[model samples]
Target: MNPCRPEEPPTVGVEEEYFLVHPGSRAVVPASARVVARASAALGEDVAGEFTEFQVEGRTQPCSGARELRAELCRVRTALADAARAEGLRLCASGTPVIADADADVSGDRSGDSTLTYISDHPRYRAGVLQYRSMLDDFAVCAFHAHVHLPDRETAVLTCNHLRPWLPLLVAMSANSPYHRGRDTGYAGWRAVIRSRFPCLGPPPYAASLAEHERLATAMAATEAMLDPGMPFWDVRPNPHLPTLEVRAMDVLPDVADTVALTLLIRALVATAASRAAAGDPGPRTGAELLRAAYWRAARDGWPGHGADPLTGRVLPYAVQAQKLVGHVRPALRAYGDEDEVTAFLDRLASRGPGAERQRARMAAEGRLSAVVDGLVRETCPDR
Candidate 1:
């Protein structure tokens, strides 16, 4: 047994990015600067700016289980919503904005240029835009990020290795962005496709040791290809500032319960992997090409469609894939008192379908993309 292993399960923290849209028009508005300013002033540092001026990100404090995670997520969402309302804008948790009217013109007096208007004015974001150009503009997407605490950097890196094969399953579960720029993108999570354009964003290569991971990062940073160590935006990577593994595969889920469920699933998965690593298991040896294909398949066809089996790379029913994932992490789930919640949530998700399916259904029913936005805003502000 590993003496360094903590008695308690790792704590989970969630970071969610949202779009600030005009309540009536449903168009993404360049109001995040104002909204974040007011929200951060009222809600502390958790409220922050995202890549685009139309987006805001909220984070939760590290929490032990689904109960505390759910409460903290709700509080953060409520705080963001309250602040957005105070600024006369509505906050939405959808992965992509439903509205396509980019020329809506956010400039009141400054510059008077709408093309140069939507990107955030923050220095880091500006640097990203300058470096990536159209790619950054195409990334009006939001995501639900989970941070799972680990004992040390070594364990964090090892957990990422063990966690690789399972990333696509989580992507399928949390696939939320179907509609992009006012039209159906024909993919459950178009955000994945958009984010893939980044040279540093994707599944990480297998590292022989923690030193290998550092060397890869150092090389990437050396090329000036990435802004910093944090710029190598792997689907799962060791957090730059925290002793945690940050999973970025999932789109920004619409429902709070879904978000909490995803968090619990991630926590369980990481715990299971860390346990196995402690027991001398080196994780799966899946090939890089197969892994990339698995993620692409999930992004293209979420739940209710076929998913690549995590272990074998064979096509399987989405339900079957989800079952396999649950089986893999069940022990950790029970340890954290999350077995029931995770199982029930996945079952319901399979039965009713994920947010992408629901969005498509609404678009079909109402015969307008705006209705999808309406549904997303309603789901985002469930308490309202």
Candidate 2:
């Protein structure tokens, strides 16, 4: 297949995960089964269960542009929120749960042990819980994934290389998890911190070819680092079953506008990268260690904080790097007719700060984590 042309931009799809929380206490509630059933009746297959019962995922069909994507996002989110309300729970789009019943003994047999009770009954999730143990205890974190169509597996692998240098910026831009387990974790995106505990965490390794990527994935599976080659858990990767590059570096955003903005930016980034690769650009050969450091810093400080440029080893404010990313992908954005919308979103981010900063401000004003959760719930499905 030929690479995606500038005039014919690739279709994009998005998957967003959300939390079900108590209305007054804001504690995560394990009600996904009921909620998903109710929501699926309205949204059909777009609504599904996640690893834990406290979480639910909504997927959008492939969309040609930001406007269509935004409509789908709003529809699914509104449906899920209404379903949660029907189940006497509120929907939250934050990356981490603000509060949880950490000590509740859900299993009648296991006294004082609520470890595996929250996990969904799916075999895959059960296996993950048994293998990872305590790692799944507080694993209610949610993320936003954008799938950008590519010509083929080879092109998608190459595009992953092109996307490495910018992954940290995406992380910082979507930082939403400021508090976890009922208290501030002192990090911008605590969800990133929790995810770092996984064996295949951070940006994926650079692979010169599809064969090399397969070799690495096979080795990781052999080591039991992940369940299989299909589950690398990297920030970005070529989808194992789809003809698209899936970016999983971002947190689930509260606002649909932010979600649409990020999705447009990701589509532009993929288009620009694939175009460069078609023109014989091998993409930046950033070292894995440098990229790891950059990701950690981005997760720690978020935007307006110092961020390291993995390509140059130069540390700059995240806002500077964000502008540079916009400049880098300006041509593609313009080609997709997303320049104005994306620029306006960035301006709004600059003025009001990303979700993490806004969350922290709300915490300060209300002096309560529940208030922050309230704000997130309000922002999550404002249309409903």
Candidate 3:
């Protein structure tokens, strides 16, 4: 996560990604006019559009903690769906849609050069086609992005540094990118690898302060690589325009509730880390060691990395890791009145593991690939 670190109060915001599904066939659709029109109306004034024509992002008003984050996510998702449904469109939170071809490039012109579409313009979309021409050599990709506001850039940097180790866990937590272009790709989070094609992406650079981080950003800027801020494309990143930390790793989830829960968790993490930082306490585990641990797990096992501290070279089983994770974060969640949210999310994770695991189970059992795509959204669709 590229951020500024300093001691201060913590602020929170959320950005959620959605797949615009055609209500007629439950297939992916380029959620352009309808998605934007309805979402702009349905979401509060804070909602913003993402780069993808089919994707839209909703942000929270600066929030206090887990409970507030939950409320913010709930309200935003309800409004987003309300807007999407208004035009016979359904919102899907899955990391990757069932049909890789679920969505259409409504712009009819892929002019943009950034994977993070700044707008749906023929020139810009076409610009995107020409850019990232090297990294996108393999596999198709789609993604959802979320952001959390902080009190200041400096504090945002601190939260980012501390949270780096956990970004993979968050991705593992939000593992929804199981399929690739309508096929059951074996990887749990294939998009994670696919998106790494861009320059200066994947994990973040090491820096102690936002100033140094900016220096790095400045250096990258000199290379003329930033077609869009979204193009920097790290898993846990920040938005320069918005006063928030943007978490870009999660595959869009099927259920808005899961997204909500994940938002709550992120808010809790930021709040807790900020609280610790405010009192001169050490913050979350970050840096090269932690980042290495998380990246390896997310790339290999996805969320099940919860079981072992790959960084410490411990091969603890999944059960042990689960206990460790609960032990570490439960107090924070409980303090935020989010124990229930944590529990519900855990149940879903345990039952299905990651989306990739679930997809594999189905595909292996049925010996049919289409079933995997068809059910990806349905399986993870919002639970109530």
TM-scores for all candidates: the values are 0.93, 0.96, 0.76
The runs of at least 3 residues in candidate 1 whose Cα sits more than 4 Å from the true structure, single-residue gaps closed, are: 1-7, 104-115
Question: Where in model 3 is the C-alpha error above 4 Å?
Answer: 1-11, 23-27, 44-48, 62-75, 82-88, 101-119, 122-130, 134-149, 228-232, 275-296, 305-311, 315-319, 360-384
Is candidate 1 or 3 superior in TM-score? Answer: 1
- Model 2, C-alpha of 288: deviation from truth (Å): 1.0
**RMSD of each candidate relative to the true structure:** 2.8, 2.0, 5.1
Per-residue accuracy of model 1 over 1-384 as CA lDDT, tens digit each:
131343357888999999987878888887887888787865698889987788999999999888899899888888888888888888887888778575743232233333456667778776775577666656788999999887477777777888898888888888899988878889998888887777778788777678888888888877866777654678888888877789988999888888888888888888778877767777787788888888889999988889787578789987888888889877777767887888778877968789999999998899987788888888987875
- Candidate 3 lDDT at 240 equals 63
Supply the global lDDT for candidate 2. Answer: 0.86
Model 3, position 18, has a per-residue lDDT of: 66
TM accuracy, model 3: 0.76
Model 3 / residue 101 / CA error / Å: 4.2
- Per-residue alpha-carbon lDDT of candidate 2 for residues 1-384, written as tens digits (9 for 90 to 100): 245476577899999999999997899888999999999988998999998888999999989988899899988998999999998999999998888766632221334654457678888777776677667667778999999988478878888899999999999999999888788888888888888888877788898878888889889888878777866778889887778899999999998998998889998888888888877788899998888889899999998699899978999988888888899989889988998888888898889999999999998999988889999999999865
lDDT of each: 0.81, 0.86, 0.60
